[model samples]
Target: MGWLIFVWALTACTENPVDHDIRPPTTLEGEWLVTAINDEPLTTANGQAGSWLGFSAGAEVVRWEPGCAQLMFLYTVDSDDFRADAIRYNVPYDKPIFVPSKFMPPPCAIGWPPRLEEAMEAMSLARKIELTQSGSVLLSGEGRSITVRPR
Candidate 1:
């Protein structure tokens, strides 16, 4: 009876199995300037400003500013996982060209900047967020990737 009681006490004091599936929080709030895509450096062309991304904490939204117009995306971040859905362009209605008319659809309906489209595609496909040693953030998915630096 004494040996049986000792064995039961030891089993009761044993710890449960540890859970290794927990992930670390990914810090991705604030503005970030696009620096590279797929390991290639990005540059401003024809005197045009480069692209950028803005993230607001607890907002679940991300804004992509690519010189001409801003594209807003509905996004979710879970630990190191990131996913974005293309919503719509934040076009200014003050501009007559941007306003939808019977003759012309909205500017977004026509087309978007090539760079902006590329960035948006990459973001939408992004599945992982990695922090670089150089203080840059990398979003990668499949064969595509986007690198950004805090502004």
Candidate 2:
């Protein structure tokens, strides 16, 4: 019996090793920075910029003005791919909402109401986020791509 076990082990070792190097999907779980946020102008005066909000790897959050907040995405793993629920603020207009207000929840006591609520819903139904482990590339909804580096 022992010899049989040894023989099986030797055979297994001679065969190809399992492909443990398979790449995993991108999860944008940690902080991410905003390089750009391009949006067509609804009107000549109300043109919006890149993402309304952006987040750094740690906790540095940035919001674009005259535009939506940059995206500060925190991902949740769902089977093979990763999912995130991020909210974009309406620049300075909604910055006050992020502060502790009389009728707001602890986490969002100071943020804007309509924008935050709308973003929450939009994020849920937003397109899928994809990443390549090797290069840390971020794929946007319209197939737009960005290269990400770990901090």
TM-score of each: 0.58, 0.30
Point out where model 1 deviates above 4 Å: 1-25, 46-58, 66-70, 88-114
In order, the Cα lDDT scores of the candidates are: 0.61, 0.37
Predicted candidate 1 versus true structure: per-residue lDDT over 19-59, tens digit per residue = 22444236556777777777666756664545534333335
The TM-score that candidate 1 achieves is 0.58
Model 2 residue 48 lDDT?
A: 48
Residue by residue across 1-151, what tens digits does model 2's lDDT show?
9999999898666312222255444354454433222211111225542233333433322221212333344545443343444443443444544343344334432344223433333333435443443334333344332333232
Global Cα lDDT for candidate 2: 0.37
